[model samples]
Target: MTCKFILVTGFLGSGKTSLVKHMLSDWGESARVAVIQNEFAASGVDGKELKLANDQFELIEINNGSVFCVCLLGHFIHTLERLLDEYQPDYIVLEASGLADPINIVELLQADELSERLVLDQIITLVDAANIERSLAMLARTRHQIMIADVVLLNKQDCYPGDLTELSRLLRSMNPHAAIYPTEHGRICLSQLTESSHLAAGQYYGRQSADRPEQLSACVVRVHQRFTQENLNALLAELQHDCIRIKGFVQTPEDVTLSFHSVFENCQVAAVSSYSGAAELIAFSETLTSKQVRQIVRRYAS
Candidate 1:
């Protein structure tokens, strides 16, 4: 029988490791499971965190880029084949890098030989409430990781004010169809993450060139003057670029500052509250980095 696989993703310090540890204990002897952890930076960091207590489940580590990219594609399939041949566990769980995106990871289970042995079970993307603003401003990769999630686990809710109204609006814009669950310290019920029986979309994905005129530029600037319907569409068209994400607040001339975020090619702008602040924006792309981001944000300072 083909094994079921779940891809868990989030930014660093999002409590993914803590969630996995609890899951292992919850399964107990009922379900035989295996773990595959892909670490972008340190190989052993996430693997060591999920220390297995017995032979009920086995854990494998894949350290490098990610399981979805071409460079590590061969390694990813090879490791799965080995796991199927050796353990043949009933289920598999993938702990993707904090910087990893789930769009490609889900595509893997839908394409090629690996699909034969492993079937996609669910995609759980953890969101860190405390560091989300900084992550959004600093890393485009982390934002994309959240865009393709099937079940978004909003971890670290205790750290911040439970501002679900704002979070819901942001998440809806990223995917519009994912189930969002807010949790404290990664304390989600095991059934919530593991019991979802939805299969992943088997479509393939690759980094493609941005199709807009501004996409061709090294740095495409997008300004959200307000949440006006016409202006929002114009802003999206102007900020086209390869691998870009947007976040921050927008201020209208009417003195309203709205929280805004964009994941992948999708952008969401809405009025949150009225403040004297001006509409602000921070963007990420191959050509945009931390230094450039600050400069860009300052340029649109309210």
Candidate 2:
């Protein structure tokens, strides 16, 4: 049977590795699987994560800056061909580097010889709930990632307490067709990734609404702070309507590094990662001005 390839991508620190690991666990014994990871670090992270399953699954690592560059396209094509010839697996999964532009990867697959061997199944993008709102406005890559995805998994959800109705409303306006799922630690049903067909040509990318021109200018900020429960709640409550999303990494008085994801009016919070770091907060909204955000930050900083 011809193989179906699912290209997975997300920004740095977005749990792409964890998501792939979980998916492998659920793939069952019936399906033959192969995975290709494109990484920026000299050390291959996915290889180590998938080591236990190495015997059963064919795994290959591409250590390059980003898969989107023409410099690495030749290597990607060569490695892909080699993997297919050796494994003949029923499914192929490619995880692109976080900073890598997914649209370019999709365009590469649409080209000559490579397109013949593998069919584009879906572009599954893992979004960092903590950083997405800000990243979406600041990075074109973020918006482009969402625009091309068949499935948008909003990961690291346990870390924010913002709003969901606004999130769904904004994302819907940005790309109406893609299914969006909120997940904690990248936990989501495998079916969400695979149970859909590739979107038709014209439907792959969608335009943001004119009213949300600010979404085109998304930005992210990470604040590392220890706060009283009331202070933490107050900080987030103030940000709920001010930006697209506010992901909070609050060090509660209880000695827990609490995380939360807020999209508009729907906010979900849970305790995640005990490792302490400055709280990372990402705020994004359509046409958000730097001055406006500075004010929001000052309000919380005080």
lDDT of 1 at 172: 63
lDDT of 2 by residue, 15-109 (tens): 77778888788886778989888765333434544654334688888864566666677788877778778888888888876556666555666
Q: Which parts of model 1 have CA positions greater than 4 angstroms off?
A: 52-55, 194-302
> Which candidate leads the pack in TM-score?
2
lDDT of 1 by residue, 59-130 (tens): 898864666666677888888888889988888888876656556665566567776778777778888776
Q: How well does candidate 2 match the true structure in TM-score terms?
A: 0.65
Which model scores highest in lDDT?
2
lDDT of each: 0.63, 0.66
* Model 1: colliding residue pairs: 251-279, 278-302
Each candidate structure's TM-score, on Cα atoms with residue i matched to residue i, is: 0.64, 0.65
Runs in model 2 lying further than 4 Å from the true structure: 52-55, 200-302
